[model samples]
Target: MGIQYFSQVLIFGSFIGLLGWTITNQVGRTQLQVKSREDWLLDGTGLTIQGILIPLLQATLVYWLYQYLLPIQQGYLKLPLILAFVISFVVIDYLYYWNHRLLHTKLLWKVHQVHHTVTQMDVLGTSRNTLWTSLLIVYLWIHTLFLYLLADPTGYLLGVSLTSTLDLWRHSRLIIPANTKLYQFLSPWLILPQDHAWHHCCKIHNYNYGANLKIWDKLHGTYYKSKNMPSIIGIPSSLNLFQKLFFPFS
Candidate 1:
């Protein structure tokens, strides 16, 4: 329970901090100014659903389901802290890489396309997606499974919190300068903002589907390295607000 509380605090604190930074920074302020009522509706709704409701639903449903199906296996896997963190951070991250890539495929694109409609790299747009899109995301299922199985999920929860925090950061305009030592250190392994910006690029949206690491994309040949942000981001969507929120299919 303490670990769970810590994870929640970490994730929420990062979000509030990012949001504060975005609102105060000049460029971020400019970007926020361009958001229309529709954009607000979509982004706000998405954030609420994904951040609050979906998590609650996942915890309730997955825990109950696991209780019935694997009662004896609850907290069965007792792993070392480092190994548990590695499983959540590295192993599950790789799985999500494919899961994210699969969302771009023809069949699932309709459900995922709403996320790509944001014209800018605003933190508010981080969770913008169809209300049901979380259901398709592998994290909703896999993360819960591991949490249920792990006897001590402290390290695993840490990874989950960090991943959630990074998700918010990557979608925002808060970028690291290419020439900086910090950028040099993190660029090789981590998927930085510029890397994710290209994924949202209007022209070449097929590449860079990894969530936390760039290695998955590099290994799968989906990585598109760039020191600069994309000139244009987000695909044009013709769907109405209702369609975007409920059924994003054309």
Candidate 2:
């Protein structure tokens, strides 16, 4: 398991590194780049902790759960592996939609605000989060449980990896204009940078909480659509990178 996790990190790290560079050059909303180089360094640090270390912690927790709480190695659920994967994917997305919305509330908002201080869109920025962000996330626990319960089905693993990888595009400077036919066709089901930017680019009334899908937002009332990009990004913040990293608990 340790080796597997390491491999996953190595591959994901490489992919994200290259993707960030590409998108930064191609479509990186230059108008929104308001942070300093030091801040960008901090953003990198946040991603390392959130995207890499947090997943390690999650795997450790899942391992413990698998070892004791869930003793069935061959999977108790008799459903097909693909079906289980699809079901878990949708369920996890729905769970994230609510959790993300909750994070924007008054009390919980501070913890999540660390990521919102970036003031710009960068692919690597997707993973820039305080430690508490993923620690309290519902899917971290629920998906881990599902991984063990479903006997680590191939489809489940694939779905998770693919969607997680694709999540990078949402945070990237990349944009598929809403006016395009393809964008219109997928608007109901998928979330692109434009839909997601509304959340980070605004101080209030942000929309589109679903991570990989916009179904929840479409079903609910949080979905926002706009062809024009945000003029200004990020909320006003006085905390330095270090303070932001350990804030609320610092």
Q: Give the best candidate by lDDT.
A: 1
C-alpha TM-score for every candidate: 0.97, 0.84
Pairs in clash, predicted candidate 1: none
What does candidate 2's lDDT look like per residue over 159-209, in tens digits?
676566657777766677767998778777887876777888765436878
Q: Where does candidate 2 stray beyond 4 Å? A: 1-14, 17-35, 72-74
Where is model 1 poorest over a 10-residue stretch in terms of lDDT? Answer: 241-250
lDDT by residue (145-173, candidate 1, tens digit) is 98899999888998999999999999988
lDDT accuracy of residue 197 in candidate 2: 78
Candidates in order: C-alpha RMSD to true structure: 1.2, 3.4
Q: On a 0 to 100 scale, what is the lDDT of residue 80 in model 1?
A: 97
lDDT of the structure predicted as candidate 2: 0.71
The prediction achieving the highest TM-score against the true structure is 1
Error of 2 at 63 (Å): 2.1
The positional error of residue 213 in candidate 1, measured at the CA in angstroms, is: 0.7
Q: What TM-score does candidate 2 reach?
A: 0.84
